[model samples]
Target: MRVFVCLFLVSVLGCSLAEGKVVSKCDLKKEFNNLPESEWPEGHTMTDNFLAKLICHVEKASEFNTSAVNQLIPKKKEEEEAEQWTLYGLFQLSDHLICSDGATPSPDRICNVTCSALVDDHIEDDISCVLNIARKVIDGGFAVERKREFWRMVKLIFQPDCNNETAGNYFAECKD
Candidate 1:
């Protein structure tokens, strides 16, 4: 009986550990709501739409898993392997462009952050990096003058699904 109890306890603890840092919708919603103006999307876009788009990106990127990591897929086969660069965290920010993996060492490191920082449960850095990227894109007149170019970039992040028409209150659904 003692051995059986120990085994059961070990299995349960192991399962919990394996589950990793997946945040609930409401929890993520709270984080989004608490963000400053600079860390959020701007212009005439509704706040709800911003939240919805965030959920869409998270869903498409890492399925809301904070610790998720994905390989970068290049167009050409000889462009090196998929292991060279990686995407991390909920937004799937690339190590190549935004963060440094430490090993590969992104020279620009546009975010000036470690990739692991984005992959963890703490999302403050991830949000900041995302905003920086958004600002760079929007600054280039993509979000205003060239609507198609803006959409092309946004759609690039959430490709296949952006091509479809789907609507939902991604954050509101978390409300009581």
Candidate 2:
């Protein structure tokens, strides 16, 4: 009887702990609001009411995909843009880019094409352009190191594992 009672108590405690880890809409809204305006794409405005609904969409996403969504809660201003872009890519993939409409291209193909266009905007080589964009995204990392890191992050968001409802909502709300 004592063993059964102990097991019951342990299960209850574990359940409570798990519940505590579940982020509420209010918590997500606060986190979203904390991000700097400059980190968002131009003309995008994040409001508390909007965020509440956005969090609901995010909740429907897989935990692995939403892990990148959690990273958007900025702890520092310097790296916020990189985090923003990562989040942006996820939303772009989930909502608009990764379509099964038969005519739409694959997500990686689209990302590569977009990145290539961005690279073409610069007079420098591809590596240099990537590094420069990485600097602009986050502000202060070594050029070579950030270049590799940036591409890795870009690829990660393009992976099939990262699509979620939060991303879809973001694209719907923010994209023209």
Against the reference, the lDDT scores of all candidates come to 0.65, 0.37
lDDT of 1 by residue, 3-35 (tens): 999999999766644544887756766776777
Off by over 4 Å in 2: 1-22, 62-176
In terms of TM-score, which candidate is strongest?
1
In Å, residue 94's CA in model 2 sits off its true spot by: 4.1
Give candidate 2's root-mean-square deviation (CA, Å).
17.8
Q: After the best TM-score superposition of candidate 1, give how far the Cα of residue 73 lies from its true spot, in angstroms.
A: 2.1
Supply every candidate's count of residue pairs whose N, Cα or C atoms clash at under 3 angstroms.
Answer: 0, 1
Q: What is residue 96's positional error in candidate 1, in angstroms?
A: 0.8
